[model samples]
Target: MDSSSPAQGAARSADLAALDVRITGCRACPRLVAWREEVAATKRAAFADQTYWGRPVPGFGPPDAPLLVVGLAPAAHGGNRTGRMFTGDRSGDVLYAALHDIGLASRGTSVRADDGLELYGVRVTSPVHCAPPANKPTPGERDTCRPWLVRELGLLRPTLRAVVVLGAFGWQAALPALTEAGWAVPRPRPAFAHGARVTLVRRPEPDAPGTGPASAELFGCFHVSQRNTFTGRLTPAMLRQVLATAAESAGLPTRSPWTS
Candidate 1:
């Protein structure tokens, strides 16, 4: 099937939903599987009575969103417990707050999956779905998890015009996936910096013929981790500035619908 066909795009949208289900069931890496489950079983004192998701976390937001936000992975007690990316953690507090301030999020906090928070023109995902030990996924684990992201980008390609990578890790992971998904990655690859920006032209694939070529932009921002936020290395203003640039590049309204 030509990947660019409307029928195919619809099928891909359904596949993306199916992929989310599959992501929540993945036990691809023995280490990640063990760690996630072990943490779930040993429940933290504060959340001892709650049942943890204890599985890979899936991407959240509209599939046709123009802005895609990529993070490193789920937090051990955060997403691992709440089952939503950037939910139930301090990092999430900072991220959602910034998103709200910039008019991307409907609310300033995301405590649970059913919190009724909504995103405008944006989606959030991660390079590695499963939370890893010490908050770090090994190179082998990252490579093993690449296919899911590759498939996700393929499904999101039509409307995806800009990407906001949270950190260097996400920046590294997204580059290859974008390339595999048909974006012409520049040689020497763009370096990762807090405010880095790169524009790549999409190339039509023989196997997945699309409507000619399209251009997309990539923006870099420091992760909304407590380590960075608490230390003042990544202020909310800084984060909003990068997102504002991305939103403009994606042809989205700079001011959110709810904002003045």
Candidate 2:
């Protein structure tokens, strides 16, 4: 499919169910395909007996979320193993805990896709769906995976108003996809920094009625990687502050007082 074709956009804009089916079946990048499968086959010691999802991990959470959380890619033994973004990993532990504390997540831990943990007014996704070798995706691989994200943004345009990008990689990758999906990105784009914010107004499109030029804000946060969390580069308070800000900007309900 032509990444920019109207048909592709229509397909992705259908619904999360359709988009998910396409995402998991993707084998567009040879390197990613081999690496994800290789890791699944070899298996991590602790999860040796568990069956790995071994495919592209789809974004998870409410379909009509007002907020979107974008990450770099799946980890070798994390999302790639569990078929859910951020699941089965330290990074997910940090992220979901904050979301839970802030009232966006139903639970503080996401061990598997069926963990009964639901997100309120929020969704989690990544720039690259498949796990890359050494936790890094080549520029070519990133570009190749761009369409899926672009289409996803298009689908979520109606309600999405705030995006929290984790780390510089997700920030860089998100700009083009947002632009392609019709958000008016600024020239010489705003540099990525912790807590940095940029607002982009959606562009009017004939096919996209009732969705003309709605504004969305982007907020930056340090990746919830073990490297950053363990070093105190990104603390629970720091991440929660960013999420609270983004949620407010999206007009999501205030976090429940009972949440902790």
Candidate 3:
């Protein structure tokens, strides 16, 4: 089953919603705080008239998602302006388009938070919520913002069966957060490589029986940044293969992702 009893599902949904609200208000890192706000205030030339989200961007998708996609962070003008992960960004463009091709998304394009795009059985989040000065978050900043990912994994522990981490940065970041959230990380920790798969485990609790799944698989994929996509380092077919595999691993519905 995709979720637990309706009551339990509702409770978790509420908790996830609450968590997202808290994420938006967080200003834990001073550097990140100044950068995000400064960008929002100065504004990009194309978006000069638009109001920026100017704060942390939270995860987006169903509370009972069976799969999670972890990325590095929000784009300076993308999620930072739109207030939605992957929205108004080139990276988001490739990711969502592949998602739609694999039949996991309602639409292939997402321009704004109000664009009505939706994901089925999948959630997208980042280790760092705030956009960094040069699209890179310091190790200190990543560690500081980790509590949010840890909390999100805890809430989704009941239903999340697999994860697809984009880039080495997210892979490294997510492993620790997942471990902190109750999933076991393999000793010597798995390294990131496109299409790599690792299944993390959880010991069944004798005290609390029948909580959630006992194990979850993690998949690695190249970041869908313009650098990767534009250079064909991560082709659309390659992306479709990884996403389709991860979606099926999570027990989500799927059709063949290839279109001749």
For residues 16-96, could you state the per-residue lDDT of candidate 3 as single tens digits?
A: 898787778777788998999999999999999899999989999999999999999999999999999999998999999
Between prediction 1 and prediction 2, which has the larger lDDT? 2
Question: How well is each residue in 1-260 modelled by candidate 2, as lDDT tens digits?
Answer: 23233236336547887887778878888899999999999999999999999998989988899999999999999999999999999999999998998888989999998889899999999989999998999988888888889888988888999999999999999999999988999999988999999999888878766762279999999999999999999998899999999999998875644423
Candidate 2 pairs with clashing backbones: 202-213
Question: After superposing candidate 2, which stretches have Cα over 4 Å from the reference?
Answer: 1-13, 256-260
lDDT of each: 0.85, 0.88, 0.88
Question: In candidate 1, what are the lDDT values of residues 47-145, reduced to their tens digit?
Answer: 999999998898998888898899999999999999999999999988888788778889999999989999998889998999899999998788777
Off by over 4 Å in 3: 1-14, 205-207
Which pairs clash in model 1? none
lDDT of 1 at 248: 82
Q: Estimate each model's TM-score.
A: 0.91, 0.93, 0.93
In model 1, which regions exceed 4 Å deviation?
1-14, 207-213, 256-260
